[model samples]
Target: MPNVPAERRRVTLQRPGPLLIEGPVEVTSENGTTVSSDRFRVALCTCRRSSIYPWCDTSHRRRAGADDPRRAQPPPT
Candidate 1:
């Protein structure tokens, strides 16, 4: 077979939200594992808050009076 470049995808950057891409897409992890989505649009989580690992479940959304576990607090008086 002749050498050819891989297909390029259209990705939309959503601040504080998942990285949206036109699917179906195949994502390969650093450990050599892979995951896929067949939806019209795929949401890849950037904040590591998704229970589905590489996929986004909107867990990054801010909730009322919810304290972020990753934030540093001031010293108590």
Candidate 2:
């Protein structure tokens, strides 16, 4: 079979949100752990709050102000 080159991919930066990238992507942590995904598009997390590290889970959409009622509060002492 003839060898074929992969198409060039582009990345889109969404304001106040995750970075959208064309995938088959592999993300590696500082400790050398790697995670990969073959999705047509991937949302890379910018905010550190994601429970699923390196992937956006909409955790960045939460209100940032203390006045916002939707913000998670600490347990009462």
Candidate 3:
């Protein structure tokens, strides 16, 4: 049998800096567990310290969307 990926997986980019995930999602971690959900749209925290865990708690507002520039920046000299 051939392997098949979920056809419903999709991602949306928001202007205010929120990534919207749609359809079925399979979130996996090193803990050997995977979280699956059918939520239409869900937000994931990029701040890495979200009080809401996987969801964004608007923590980015504290730094005005500049909390982790180094996260996307190249290695320091």
Looking at candidate 1, what is the lDDT of residue 65? 24
* Model 3 lDDT per residue over 1-77, tens place: 12456575578876455567874566664676666556777777665567765676777677755655544765799
Q: Write model 2 residue lDDT over 1-77, tens digit each, in one string.
A: 11446667789997567888898777887799889888989999887778897988878877335445766889999
**What is the Å distance of residue 23 in model 3 from its true position?**
2.3
Error of 3 at 33 (Å): 3.4
Q: Model 2: residues >4 Å from true position, as ranges? A: 1-7, 64-77
Rank candidates by lDDT, best first: 1, 2, 3
- Full-model lDDT for every candidate: 0.79, 0.79, 0.64
On a 0 to 1 TM-score scale, where does candidate 3 land against the true structure?
Answer: 0.55
**What TM-score, computed on C-alpha atoms, does each candidate reach?**
0.69, 0.69, 0.55
Give the higher-lDDT candidate: 1 or 3: 1
Q: On lDDT, who's better, 2 or 3? A: 2
Off by over 4 Å in 3: 1-5, 14-16, 65-77
Model 2 is weakest, by summed lDDT over 10 consecutive residues, at 1-10
